[model samples]
Target: MVFYCQRHCYETKYTTKVVSCKPAKIDVVVDGKKKKTACYEVTFEDTILFPEGGGQPDDRGTAGGVEVVRVVRRGGEAVHYLAGGLEEGATVTQEVDWTRRHDHMQQHSAQHLVTAVADNLYGFATTSWYLGEAVCHIELHTGQVTEEEMAKIEDTANQKIRESTPVTIAEYQASDPRLIEIRTRGLPEDVVGAVRVVSIEGVDANMCCGTHVDSMADLQAVKLLHTEKGKAGKTLLFFVAGSRLLSYLGECVSRERGLNTLLHSCPADHTRLVEKNQKELKGAQKSLREALKDLAVCEAKTFLGVEPRPPAFFHHRHDGDNDYLSAIINEINDESVLKVLTAGEDKGPGILVVHGPPALVAQIGPRVCEILEGRGGGKTRFSGKVTRLGKRKEAEKYVLGALNGSVKET
Candidate 1:
C-alpha cells in the first residue's frame, strides 16, 4: 500500500476518518523511573503522519487536535499513539510536524546520494545505516575508509546536490521484472502491495519506502564528520546534512571560542599547547609521588623515635592515595605497633589501611571501616575505600582506646 504521507511528501495536513481507536499503554521514564503511560492506539483511513520505518523515526504531530506521541507500522496500517482518545469513525484533521518531517526527508535523501557515490567510486556497499538524534551514519561493507577516500565521496555527493539533481520515485508490483536492476537490502517479510523505488536522477536508484526530499537541492549540504570501525570488518561513515550540518558547524565554532579563552591560544595552536600542558602535568605528578614516598619514611621515623612508642598510631594526610598509606606501614616494618592510615580529602572521600598483629588487625579493621562509612576485611592488613572522611577523628579515638584496653589486659 502507498501511504498518504509517502504519496504526498509535501502535504502537512489531511482530513480523514478515524478507522479505529483502542486503549493502549506505553512505557515511559518519569524522574528516572520507568512506568507505563496510558494512550490510545488510533488508525485513520489515511494519515499525513509517517510511521517509524526504513531507519527513519516516526513523525511527531497531532491527530484530532490531540498530540501524537508515536507512530508505528502494523502490517499495512500506520498506527498512531495519541495521548488523548479519538472516537472511531469520527472525522478529524491530522497535522504533520513539518520541521521534523523536512529534516528526516533531507537526511534520508542524502543517505541515498552518499551511498550511491561511495558504491560507484569504490565498491563499498552499505551494510546498514542509522539516523541518530544528532547525526547519521552509514556502515559500509569495506574494512576501512581512508581520509582521502572520505573526502572524495563527500565532494562527489555535494557536487550532485549543487547540480540540484531531481529525486523521483516509482512504485511497482512485487513480481515486476524491472525490480531485477534495482538495489535493495531486502523487503520485510510482511511487506504488502507495491515496492517503492527512490531514484536520484542519473546517479542511482534503489528500493526505499522512507520519505525523501524532492531534489538534491533540498539537502543544501553534506558534511562527512569522520569514520569509525564497525563490527564484522566494516567502516561507519558519519555525516550531517542540511540544517544538521549548520548546527554542527555552529557547535564547533562555539567550542573553539571556549577553548581560546581557556588555553589562551587560537584553534591553530590548540594541539601543540594541549600536548605541552599534558607533559607538564605528568612531570608534576611524578614529583608529587616521590615526595609522598619521602614523607612516608619521615612519618615512620617520627613514630619510632618516641621513647614509649604508642600501642596504636593514627595518621591522616589530605593528599596522596592508598599506595602512600601502604608505604608508611612498609617503612615502619613493625607488627607490634598498630598503624591506622588514611589519605585523601579531609572532609570527602579517602582510603583506609590498618596493619598490626593478626588478631588485633582482624578485630579492629571492620569496626574502623564502619565508623568511616566504608568496608574492608583482612587477616593482618586491611584496606578499603572510605567515604566519610569527616569522621576520622572518632575512628582514630576508637582504635586507640581498643589498643590501650588490649595492652592493659596483657
Candidate 2:
C-alpha cells in the first residue's frame, strides 16, 4: 500500500489517529520452518515512536493495547507492525518504548559528538556506524587508532555530556543556500524539498532523522571500549553509552572477581601464573614421551628371543603408537624375522606396524590391512591405524596365513 509523505512521528509524545491499516503477511521461522504470520501494517497520523533508519533500530511499544513489533519508514510514513489488526481511521493512543528509545538517543548522540571530536582533533572522519545490542561502533577513515587518542576523544565526549548542552532539530528546504553552512554526510538521492537537521548547540550539526534526547546531559556518558581494523583502512571504535555503560562495567567487575577465585591469584598476577603453569605442563609431557620410548625398546627384545620360530611374529599391545612401533622396529636387529605389532586401548582404534624382509613386509602389511578394513602406505616398513578395537587377532591371522601361503599377498 502507498503512504503519503508527512512529518516524522517522534516530534512529541501524542495520541493520534490511524491513517491506514491492512493485513501484512510476514514469514517467521518456527521449528526450522517458515510460517506465514498475518499481521497488521499500520500507519498513524502522528506518533511518538521512531521508525528504524540512520543506524538506529526501530522503536517498540503498544498501540491501543496491541503489541507493536517493528516500525519502518518509507518516504515520510512511519509504518508499524502490530500483532493484531487495527481499523483504518481509528483513534489510538500510542506509547514508545521509552527505555529502548532513550538508549538509542544516548548512543546516537554520543556517536555524533565523538565523530565530530575525532574529525576536529585527529582528522579522522567517520565512514559508518552500527548500533548493536550490547555495544555500538563507529568506523573512522583510518586504519589504526591508538589507546591515547581514543581516551582523549572519550574524555571530550563525556565533557560535552556533562556540560548538558541543548540539542535542536530544524528543517530547511533543499534549495536553501544556508545548507552550505551545515555539516552533513550527504542527502539521500530520493530526498526532495526540505531536509531535517539535528544540531548539538556550539558543538556540531548534521542531517539526520533518528530521535534524540533534549540535551547532552540525557546521554549520561560515553565510554570507548576498544578498536579494530575495518575495510578501506578504517578503524572501528567500539563503545557503550548511558545505562549500557553501567551494565558493561558491572559485567567486567563480575568477571574480574570470578577470575580471582578460579585462578587463586590477584588480577595483576593472573597472566603470569597462567604462563608459568603452561611451561610446567610442557616439561612433564616431554619426560613422559621419553619414558614411553625407552619401554618400547625393551618390549622388542622379548619377541626376538622367542625360539619355536613362527612364520610371522604377531604381538597385540594395548598401548603406544606409531612412535612406539618405530622405536621397537629400530631395536629389532634381526633382518629375516617378520614383525606385526598392533597397539591401542581396550575398546578403541588400533595402529599396525610391519617390518622385516622386504618381500614379507609387502605381503603381510597389505593382507593384514585388508582383513581389518583399514588403509595405509609404505614400501618395506608399513604403518596404518585401524578403526575397530580388539581386531588385533584378525590382523595377526591374515599375516600368519600369508606366510603359510594360504592367503595370497596383494
Candidate 3:
C-alpha cells in the first residue's frame, strides 16, 4: 500500500469516529484491495512496523484501530494486514500488542545469551539461526559435537541466563575488530554502512539486525530443548525462554503423572517398566507360535495319504515372507519328498507344496496359479517362486498334484 505522509502526498481523509475494536471499519484500500490496515501500520509509509527479512517471525500488533493479525515481508517491503478494512484514503492512529512484543523480546534476547554462552563454553560457533514461535534455532559453526559437549554447552548457557548479564547494542564502523565482523555474513560489496554490534556483556558480541532487550537478565530462564547434528556436520540447537520454559516444565510434569499411573510405579522406574512390558510381549508371541507349529505337523500326517503324484507345487501367501519361504525351500531341497507352506502376498506368502511325480503335476501349478496369478518354479527336484497371488485352495490342489508324482505312499 502507498504511504501517504503529508496532505500534499495524497488526498487527506480522517476518521470521524473514535478508533477501537467496535468502531465501524472504514473501507481502506490496501494495494488495490479494499481492506483495513492494522493500527500499527497507519503511520508508516512503506516502512514496516514489525520485524521482518530475517528468519524471525514478524511483530504482531494492531494498527489503524484494527487488530494487526500479521506483519509480513513479501519480496522486500514489509506489510501489515488488518482486521477491519481501511477506507481508500482514510487516516487512523496506530496501536500494538505489547504483551506479545515483550515475549518476543525475551525470546530474542535469550537467543543471544544461550548461543553466545554455548559458543564460549563449547567452542562451537552459531553458524545460522531461525526464530520460531515455540523455539529459536541456531546452527553451530562446527559440523558436530558430542552429546556430552552439548550438555556442557547447555549447562553454561543456562548459567549465563541465570546470571542475567547486560546486553549492549552499539554502532560500529566497518573498521571494527574482526571479532565483531565475524558475526554477520560478510558485508555486501556495494554497502559501506555502519553495523550495529550487540554485546551480551562478557558472554558474546555479534552483529545482529533483529531487536533485543538490554540484558540477558530480562529472560527469566533459558532452557535448551535439544541438540542434534545437521548438514555439513553442523549442530542445530533448540531452546525455549521465559514463559515458554514454564510451559514446557508444566507439560513434562503432566506427562510424568500420566505415565506413573499407567505403569503403576514411581516416576524413576518408568524406563524399567516400559522395558519389562516389551520383554513380556516378545515371550508371549514366541510361545503361541510354538503351539501352532506342533498342530500343523500333526495335521500334515493325515494329508500324507490322499494326494496326486510328482507334484512340484507353488503356493504363496503374504504372512510368510521371503525369509521363511527361503527356509522352507532349503528344507525341501534337503528332504526331496516334502510339503511347502508359505504365505502369498505381493512379496509372496501362504504358498503350499505337495510333492508328486511328473505326469500328475503337469500344468496343474500353471493352471491353478492362473486364477490367483501365482508363479512357482522347480527342477526335477524343486520349484520356487518368481511371483504369486491369491487362489489359496487351487494353490493347494497344485501342490498335491506335484507331490503325488513322487511319493508311492500317497
Candidate 4:
C-alpha cells in the first residue's frame, strides 16, 4: 500500500485515495522511445514528504543516492523519480535532508496552529495553507481579521511556542462523521482508513498528513510578515518560522545599525537627521546665492577701469572663488571679450589666474574646462561659470587689485 494522490507536488486534492505506500522497490523502464534513465518504484517509509495534495507543495530531496527529482502521483501512487534508477533487488539506505524536512514540519504544523487559534479565538477555520519561499501563508475560513488581530494571533502562536507545548500524533479509525473533523480536506471518504491527527495540547488540535515535530518549541518562533484579505472573507497570513525567524531578526538588527551609522546617531535619529539636512541645505543654498551676489559686486568694481582692447578677454581661475570669477564675467558681459571662471575645492580652491583679448583667455577656456572639469561656450566674448577656482582668497585679492589696477601688489 502507498499513501499517494494525483498531484505534481505536496498539494492535496480533495478526492478518494485508492492505495497507500508499501515498503517495496520495483524496477521500471522509463523514456522508452526517448533517452531517459531507468526509475525505481518504491514505497517511501518516512512521512517527511508531502505528496502534492490539497494545494500543498510536494516534498523535495534525494532518495537512494539519486536526487528525488519529482514525487509524481500516477494511479494513486506517488512515483518517486530518481536521477539514476536502481535495480529491482538493489538495497539503498534512503535519507531525507533534515533541514528541509524540519522547515516543512514547522510550516505544516504552524498551519494547524494558525487554524486552531483562529477557530478558538474567532471561530474561523483555515481553508488553505501555503508554505512559500521566504514566507508561509494560510487562508482563514471565514470572517474578517484586522491587521491588529493578526498580530495578536501571531503573538499567541509564539507564546504557545514559548510554552513548549507537546505535539502528539495519533492515528484513529471511526465511522462517525464527527471523526471526519480531524481529517484534512483530502482524505478518502469511502474507505475507513486510519486518520492521522496532530495535537498541540490545548493550543491546537487538527487532522494533518504532513510530518511534524514532537513539540511546538521545535518551531522556535512564528513571525508574521503580513496578512491580507483573500477570497470569500478569507485572510492570508504570511509568516516565517524557526531558523528563518532568526535570520529575519538578524537582518533587521543589521539594517538598524547601518542606518544609525549613516545618520551618526541612534536609529531614532534617522528621521530627525533627514529633516535637519533638508533645512540646512536650504540655508546653505541661500548663503551661496548671497555670496555670489557679493562676488558680482567685486567683479563689477574690478571691471571699472579695464584696458579697452578690441578683443581683450578676461579669464579668472580661482580656488573656490567662483563668485568673483562669475562677477567679473557678468560685469564685462561684452561680446567683444570672452570671459571664463573656474574654482572648486578639488582645484585647491582660491587660486586665481586671468588673461584676456590677447587670445589668452579664449584659448585657455577650453583647456581650463578640460583641466578643471568645467564647461562653457564663448566666441572671445564673456561666457563661463567658475569651472575651478582653487585659490579663492589669493585670486580674489589679485583679481580685485588688477580689476582696479590701482592697488599696487604689496
How high is each candidate's TM-score? 0.93, 0.71, 0.59, 0.54
The TM-score measured for candidate 1 stands at 0.93
Ranking by lDDT: 1, 2, 4, 3
What RMSD does each model have against the real structure?
Answer: 2.1, 6.2, 10.3, 13.6
For model 4, the superposed segments whose C-alpha errors exceed 4 Å read 1-50, 54-56, 73-76, 174-178, 181-192, 271-410
Question: Which has the better TM-score: candidate 3, or candidate 4?
Answer: 3
**Model 3 off-target regions past 4 Å?**
1-43, 46-49, 65-70, 74-76, 81-85, 93-103, 171-182, 187-195, 288-410
Q: What is the lDDT of candidate 3?
A: 0.57
lDDT of 3 by residue, 162-259 (tens): 77777776666767676444565554343334555677877677765556677566777777777777898788888888777787789899999999
Q: Which stretches of candidate 2 lie above 4 Å from their native place?
A: 1-13, 27-37, 281-410
Candidate 1 C-alpha error for residue 324, in Å:
1.7
lDDT score for residue 236 of model 2: 97
lDDT of 1 by residue, 1-410 (tens): 77999989999999999999999998767898988999999999988999988899989999989999999988888889999999888999999999999989999999999999999999999988999989999999999999999999999999999999999999999999999889989888878889999999999999988999999999999999999999999999999999888888999999999999999999999999999999999999999999999999899899989988777889999997876888899999988778888888898888999898889889898999999999777878988888998999999889878877887999
lDDT of 4 at 171: 64
Q: After the best TM-score superposition of candidate 3, give how far the Cα of residue 342 lies from its true spot, in angstroms.
A: 11
TM-score result, candidate 3: 0.59
Candidates by TM-score, descending order:
1, 2, 3, 4
